[model samples]
Target: MPKESSQRGPTADRLHRVVVIVDENSNPFELGCTTEVFGLRRPELGRELYDFRLCSPAPLTSMRDGFFTLTGVAGLEAADSADTLIVPNRPDVEVPRRPAVLDAVRRAHARGARLVGLCSGAFTLAEAGVLDGRRATAHWQWADAFRSRFPAVRLEPDVLFVDDGDILTAAGSSAALDLGLHLVRRDHGAEVANSVSRRLVFAAHRDGGQRQFVERPLPDLPDESLGPVLAWAQERLDAPLTVADLAARAAVSPATLHRRFRAQLGTTPLAWLRGERMALACRLIERGESRMDVVARRSGLGTAANLRLAMRRERGVSPSAYRRRFGPRVA
Candidate 1:
């Protein structure tokens, strides 16, 4: 299936109604992240982009960790009418889902509503059979269990999230925020998503392929990790940076740097640098940089042709098209 953007046309042209399903022992943090992304009104935009609701099989339910209880929750019918349906983290993947909840999810998907699974919520999606034969992700801690339960699903355990057409799945709690911001970007555009990210004081976009938290057997000391090196590199994204340059800065051999990157960031140095450069290009484009050559130069992509290639490879759109869709409005 094609992405929602291609199927529905530009999301900015229509209102997006989102419904989140909650159940007893649902993680409040995941729910909060969903609400923060879709529920909040962006009066600055002069109009609301999302109509958000929280629905449940029961009217009242206890939140996970037993800290609070949610009230006034709507029924499963709310999900049927939404343009998007979100499932927050469930208490356990090993347990069976309620048949009514599963049916509601299947019905929503059958009606062409986009589906999201935040953290363990992928279990719910898989149980509903919405994720069969689709690429999905969940918390790494449950990767084995998830794979064991659903062999038909292609589970990418390392990625922060997977946006598989109408079905989207996030890895864990924080990744839920990543997926939320991504949905905003896919719908409204990068400019709006960046504004929302700024309001939340969060990074507007994180590559969904980022590895989950890795446990280093020999953890680097505070000042010994690649933190300072990465910061230095970020400050000079416009400069030609190579693996050797990064290795020299970190005072380690290229081989050691590679190991560190894999151990810590779960990607190669060049791959990480390309991702950063692409991000800078996006920011420049969003700021209304009209000249492709200038945008490429400033973003360290070097040339207009290179910029076009990178944009097409990374974003699936050309520079002009991306700018037209996401650039700031000019008076």
Candidate 2:
């Protein structure tokens, strides 16, 4: 997570600052995603997670197709104070972004602030030249045009999003919510992220590498939604569940289950189960589970060594380090 900028002023002791750069012709859906995920006060969690605001090059920015006019937002100078700066999301990729907006993105990157480009917002980041040689993803429909316009960017057209350290990009409008929840999870831990997801009525975690578009958009069978099986497995995380167990629960063969998982979740059954276990482990740690054996056993990870390895691989940090960062602390 990026540190809050010194420009936070009296709110310096508050949560991380998130500023959205709303340009002319911006997509309202992605803008709503940022607001729903990061702007709302989380009274359920006893406090808010982010100090969120919106900024634009002008006071009255017109949304895509003139559906609405957004007004009363801060000016471009607000971008310098953002810990995470979200670039403009515009469908008209052919039009050039405001030079001020591009400069704000570049300044944010130079200051080590986290940068986010949702959907066609990648075009703005690319135009700023900050995304040169960096892995990014835009809306699949614009993939070819993006590549042609910016050959320097390593475009991952198929993935839902790409998290390249301080910079993140989502492929489509809906994927912006996925990336927002991911940012929360990375900064505040899984428990907090899950709370935010429940409020938004969204899946807590969708792996960034998941395909933006599933070939089978809907399940062929009415019972193949995977929701029931996933809930059952989550309830039994302490049990040694396998793919066969999941298949049996779903009343399908192993191969059928594999295909269904791929179609519905864009991931294998084993990977999803493992990810759930890791998430459980993270939640346990965040809640002050000091004993490694207890956390491992409760999360169905088997042993301390397995927990350590899994934490390192998935979080890029050891279990102890994770605890220090998110665990309950003494006053």
Candidate 3:
């Protein structure tokens, strides 16, 4: 199947209706990411897009910093009004969502608005019955907790986001960018998403799921060791770059490079490269409307069959299916 961007449906030309639900003690990392993507204006992204509003359960709110912030209670009424709604990292991990907040999420979802749950925010969505029988994801660290709490929802803790039609869930922290860029791709087409990534100076794409295999207790390795080489390799994933090529570029032997990668990133050079390739391939499928053959060639995945195997093994979707679902077209 070809990964063609859908030339159909109501394009996400603007997000004039957007809301972010913030609660007391929200994780700053995830909340900040939401604000950066939707709350802040980027004229460079589009002349007209995203009329972002911060929705709070109460008329007044408090940030993680413990300072009270005055905000209009974009209560259930305001939440139900948006075209899209975001739930950043939850504040009360030990406690379940309050009745009012849960009701607001259900109301918004019922109104046909897209709902996103970042990190443990999925717990709230699950409480609202939004993720019943749907495949969802959360930060790898919380995978066990999530499964215990929401056993009915198929939990995928490795990937960045699980795009289950109107409901989307992402892993921790930086994974928010993966889902945010995905939303851009879905709403405005590949061109718009690519433009936004470029403006933000993010690589136009990154392949693979989130870091479930992350080297826990990551060593405080010297930045001078591997950072520069990573940037160089990322810029050239399409090139015929090999471990030997990276070794040469990084001024190290292949043996040293392999050891360094294992010590720092918890994976071999080739595996990381493969992950990056698949991730880039997914971006191309959604954004460029590129076929599998083209994506395979561009991402250095070797062949269409290899790309198919990798995409399926990683995402459980064929390239065409993924493109169609995440493509600008709804169908």
All models: lDDT? 0.85, 0.89, 0.72
Residue 324: error of model 3 in Å? 12
**Candidate 2 deviant stretches above 4 angstroms:** 1-12, 215-222
Off by over 4 Å in 3: 1-16, 139-143, 158-161, 189-208, 216-224, 227-331
Better of 2 and 3 by TM-score: 2
Q: Between which residue pairs do clashes occur in model 3?
A: 15-50, 190-287, 207-279, 207-280, 208-279
lDDT of 1 by residue, 1-331 (tens): 4255223233656577888999888998899899899899998778786878999888778888678888988887888877888875676678788899999999988878888999999999999988888899999889999999999999999899998878899987789999999888877767788888998899777778888775474645544477889999999988888999999999999998898888777778888899889888988888888999998988889999999999999877899998887788778
RMSD of each: 2.7, 2.8, 5.8
Q: What is the lDDT of residue 156 in candidate 1?
A: 98
Superpose all Cα atoms of candidate 3 onto the true structure and report the RMSD in Å to 1 decimal: 5.8
lDDT of 3: 0.72
Per-residue CA lDDT of candidate 2, range 1-331, in tens? 3233333211436678999999999999999999999899888998778889999999899899999999999999999989889999888899998888888999998887888899998999999998888899999999999999999999999999998877889997779999999988888889889999999998889999898988564546465578899999999999999999999999999999999898888999999989999999999999988999999999999999999999999987899999987788769
What pairs collide in candidate 1? none
